[model samples]
Target: MLPGRTWTRLLVCLTCGGVACSDDSQGGHARAHYQETDHPVAGTLEPRSTWRWCYVHRRTV
Candidate 1:
């Protein structure tokens, strides 16, 4: 990967013969993958004198 290079080709390079995304941008992917829905952040451990969690995962039980 090149410097300052995002996961553009990385997405399309996905093997397994699947419909990979060739989007070289950083929006839909973030919303689809890194968004706080599927792989949410862990909001359980206490922050270091910050009172804030890093990966704050808010889900309904």
Candidate 2:
């Protein structure tokens, strides 16, 4: 495999921290993306997100 590609995958996983396991409408599979957030005043580093994936009416959203 390409080293760059592998490194990117690793970064994505690490950046997202832990992947939560659960049954969902997306065929039990889901992915996470980094989100830009700011609250209570901006800072050098962003805080952890409170977003998550779940099934809605048998569909992933």
Candidate 3:
């Protein structure tokens, strides 16, 4: 986490286990990680939020 930022919108890459912030967050690191690595899927890291997104399909999976 950054200096004063919370982990409200964190995501973890399913293909590589890389963690990043969502697009709505400071750096949009999740999308960047997908673009850079061509990893197709990521999932929410929130405690009770269970969802996954496919970058290739551009939808929830």
Candidate 4:
């Protein structure tokens, strides 16, 4: 991957919302995948902080 191309993709991701993004620059060889959750999940105890809940996403590159 060239530095210029990488920077371009990064700029695009920043300009657009970073919550969800798709990367197909690898020409079917490599792709970026993301999963989003509406609310944070806690299996057991919940945090006492007011800003505890947040959106989360997992990506495979």
Q: Write the per-residue lDDT of candidate 2 for residues 1-61, one digit (tens) a residue.
A: 3333222111112333433222222322123222231111111122464333322233322
Best by TM-score: 3
Evaluated against the true structure, the overall lDDT of model 4 is: 0.24
- Higher lDDT: candidate 2 or 4? 2
Against the hidden reference, what TM-scores do the models get?
Answer: 0.19, 0.19, 0.82, 0.16
TM-score for candidate 1, please give it: 0.19
Per-residue lDDT of 1-61 in model 4, one digit per residue for the tens? 5444432122112222332212333321112311222332211122443221122433211
lDDT of each: 0.31, 0.25, 0.89, 0.24
Candidate with more favorable, higher TM-score: 1 or 2: 2
- Runs of candidate 2 with Cα error greater than 4 angstroms are 6-46, 55-61
Per-residue lDDT tens digits for candidate 1, residues 1-61, read 3467455422311112122222345443423443434443221122342221222343321
Candidate 2 vs candidate 3: the TM-score winner is: 3
Cα error, residue 25 of model 2, in Å, equals 20
lDDT of 3 by residue, 1-61 (tens): 6688754588999998999998888778999999999999999988888799999999999
How does candidate 4 fare on TM-score?
0.16
